[model samples]
Each structure stands twice: as structure tokens, then as C-alpha cells.
Target: MKQVKIAGQVVPAIGIGTWHMGDRPAQRETEIAAIQAGISAGARVIDTAEMYGSGRAETLVGAALQPFSRQQLFLISKVLPENASRQRMEASLDASLQRLQTDYLDLYLYHWRGDVPLAETVAELQRLQTTGKIRAWGVSNFDVADLRELWQLPGGDQAAANEDLYHLGSRGLDYAVLPWQAEHDLPLIAYSPIAQGDAWGQQLTTNDTVKQIALTHQATVYQVLLAWVIRQPQVLAIPQTSSVAHMEQNLAAGDLILSPKELAALDQQYPRPTHKERLDII
Candidate 1:
């Protein structure tokens, strides 16, 4: 497994995302299996969010990871945009801690960007850090402008990482976010690193290059796509999987390497659309 250091802490470059595990018993069992499989495969980070099943996902993750030493895992949870106020942030973090069955999270992130003042959110996160409630703090789904605003806050320098949707099909970060993060040494936590399974069909179809490369390496299309994302400097991908077999496959992506020619060909196949176009669909 690959590792990236953020705020002086090392985290797995490939993590498990526990979003699909809702309140159902079967779903919870699958999530537990997936987490154990991922950890066995060398994943050190596990990401969950408050909006994921309205907190049920976190509870499932807590149950799954209770056997492991807390310090061995880089646990990350997010607060939704609507709960961005200082008071709400505090309450939300406490609730998430209780659900996660952990004393403190390795990282806490703002789930979205909205009307709340960035200063208030950052300040509260800083306060939590001082109290040792959260080891580090960052933002998710925030653009370059939002990051710039965050940097102006009192303790923004302590912000460890930024989470975003980054894959071969989604290159919004390439235009600005990637460069800004690189300049600031901010590690990027990539969600949908396989393009939510879209890359395996639309992006790879009729594209003989990717097919040839995958065939040459004896790897699946999903593995090829995930390898492409993890190849980027400072990128950590968290692809969700509920099945143990799929979890193993996702973890194997970290070991698959793509040739420069193959990488260039794949990049040319998926040109990113404008942010405006993306927002329209969202």
C-alpha cells in the first residue's frame, strides 16, 4: 500500500469509503467485512460522513474497527454544510465520536461549502484540535476560492488535507485545485477514484489503448483506472466497496502500474467538462 504524509502523520494512499452501509443489517455486515478486508489489504484510512445514512454509516464503521487500535487507523468524518456553525460543529463532532466508538478522529472535514462563515468553521475546528477532540481538520467539496478563504483563518495552517471528487472522468482539480494543493503541500483525498464505475464502461469503451494496457498487465479496467488516480503525487483514493471480493480488487489497484504511454492515452480519452456543466448536472 502507498502512504502519504499529511500534517506529520502518515495515511494510506488507498482507503475504504463506508457510504453505502445504511441502517440495514445486511448492509452493516457487508460494511464490517469490507473494512476488515481493506485493513488486511493494507488500507489505513477509513472515511465516513454524517450525511451518509444520517450517521448510520459512522456507527457501522465504529463497530467494524473497534478491534483495531485507534492510533493505527486514520479515521475521517465530515460535518454537513447545514451544520457548519461552531456550536453545531462541536455537537456533530461529539456525536460522530460516539458513533465511531473512538475518543478522537484523526481528521474532521466540512462536508460541503455553504453560507456559513469559513472563519467560524475553521476557528471551531482549531478549538477542537486544541482540546484534542480531533487530530486534524480540513474541508471537502471546496473550490480553490474556498481554500484561499480558509487559509486566511487564524489556524488554517494546521488544516491537513482536502477531500474532493477526483478521477480520470472528473478533472476539476487539474485546472486549479490540484495546483493550489500542490503549492500548499495539502494532500488530496480523492473520492470516486474509479469514476463511480463509469470509467470501466464509457471511458474505456472503444478505447483500444486502455484495453491493450489492461490486457498486457493482466489487470481489470477498474484496477487500471484506480491506478491512474493514485499515480498522482499526493493523492489518496477512497473507493467504497461493500463486498469482500471487491474490496480486495480495489486494494490491488495500488500495486498496478501504468506505463507512460498508457497513462497519456487514458488521459486523452477523458477530457474534463467545465465546472458550470458539472454543477448543472449536480
Candidate 2:
């Protein structure tokens, strides 16, 4: 499997994302099974957040991951912007830990910027590190300018990763964010990596180039998309799914590499941004 070094640990480039999961009691078993299937398929990173399902997702993850050794998995959760303050951060983290049924998180992130000063959040995250509740902390929905601002803070240079919306159709990060992260050796944890490009109103799934590339690799179009997302170094794709078969297929994409020719073709279909484009979000 292809691997990306994240927060000083090498993990599979493809991970399981738990967003909008654990919302329906009817689908609980299926969701747990899908996540377990990904783990059994060699996925080591499991991304969740306190905001997801208002903690239902983390609760589901806690149950799904009960059978696995904690050391074998790199678990990531996030604090809501309102809870990112020094006063409320640790308490929120504790609640997340309780939901996750774990004592510590591999990575905890500031879900987004809020009224709290960035320094307060960063300082609290650093303090949490000393408390052993979180190994490292990062940010989400952060653009290049936000990242640059973060890097200038006292403890900001220690950020382990950044989670953002990235997919074949959304290439805004390609112009600046990717380059900045690559230069700083900070890994990007991409969310919604296989949204089929429909979010941007593009029918990327039916694109001729995408179709032919999927055919060439004997993979699903979504799999081809996942492969393309993690084709670069220090990049990880966390694509959420509630089907065991789809989870397995997504994990398998870690090993699917597009050739230079194939990549050029995809580029022709969805060209990289020439200048800064609007940062796409879900």
C-alpha cells in the first residue's frame, strides 16, 4: 500500500472518514462493519470529529474500533471552534475521549476559526500535548493564508496536518496550499476526496478521461479518484463510506498508481488552478 508520513508516523495514504455517520440507528451495524472492514484491509488512520453527528460518529468509532489495538490505529478527532478556547478545549477533548473510549488521540484539530484568538487555541493545544491527551494538533478548513498565519504563531510550526476539502474537481489547493504544506513538510488530510466532483457541478464520474483511466486500472471510478488524490507525497485521503465493499475498494486504491500519461489525461479533464481559486468546502 502507498504510505504518507503524517505527524512523524507513516500511515496508509487512504484512510476511513466518519462524517455524517452514526446518524441513523438503522445503519449502525453496517457503518461499523464498513469501518472494521477498512481496518482489516490495512487502513491505519481513522478520522472522526466531535462535530460529526454531534458525537455520534465518535461513539460509533469507539465501538467499531474496540477489537483493534489502539497502537495499531492513528485516531484523529476535532474540537469545535467554540470549544477551541483554552478554557473549554480540554473539557471538549475529554468528552471526545469518552466517546471514543480512548485515553488519547493521535491528532486533535481545531475544527475551524472562531471568535477565540488563534494563539489561545494553539497554546491550549500545546498544553494538551503535555497532558498526554493528544499527541499532536492541527487545523481544518484552513487556506494557504491561514496556514502561513499559523506558521508564524509561537507553537504553530508544530502543527501536524491540515484537513480540507479536496477532490479531482477542486484544485484550488494545488496552486498554493499544497506547495506550502510540501515545503513545510506538513501532511494534508483530505476530506471528501471522492465526492465525484458533483459538489462543484462537474460530472467527473462520467468524464471520458476518468472512465478510461478506471478501465485501465480495473478499478471503480471512485477508486481511480482516490488514487489520484494521494498520488503525491505527504498527502492522505480520508473518504467516507458506509458499505463494506466500498470501504475495501477505497482502501485498495492506496495501491493504485496512475502513470504520468494517465495523470496528464486527467489533468486535461480537470486542469489545476493557474492562480488562487476559492477554497472549496462541503
TM-scores, all models, native as reference = 0.92, 0.98
lDDT of 2 by residue, 1-282 (tens): 999998778999999999989999999999999999999999999999999999999999999999999999999999999999989999999999999999999999999899999999999999999999999999999999999999999999999999998989888999999999999999999999987346667887888899999998899999999999999998999999999999999999998999999999999889998898878877
* TM-score for predicted model 2 compared with the true structure: 0.98
User: How does each model score on lDDT?
Assistant: 0.82, 0.94
Assess candidate 1 and give its TM-score to the true structure: 0.92
Model 2, position 152, has a per-residue lDDT of 95
RMSD of 2: 0.9
The parts of candidate 2 lying over 4 Å away from their true place are: 196-199
RMSD (CA, Å), each prediction:
2.3, 0.9
Q: Which residue pairs does candidate 1 place in steric collision?
A: none
Candidate 1 positional error at 72, Å: 0.8
The top-ranked prediction according to lDDT is 2
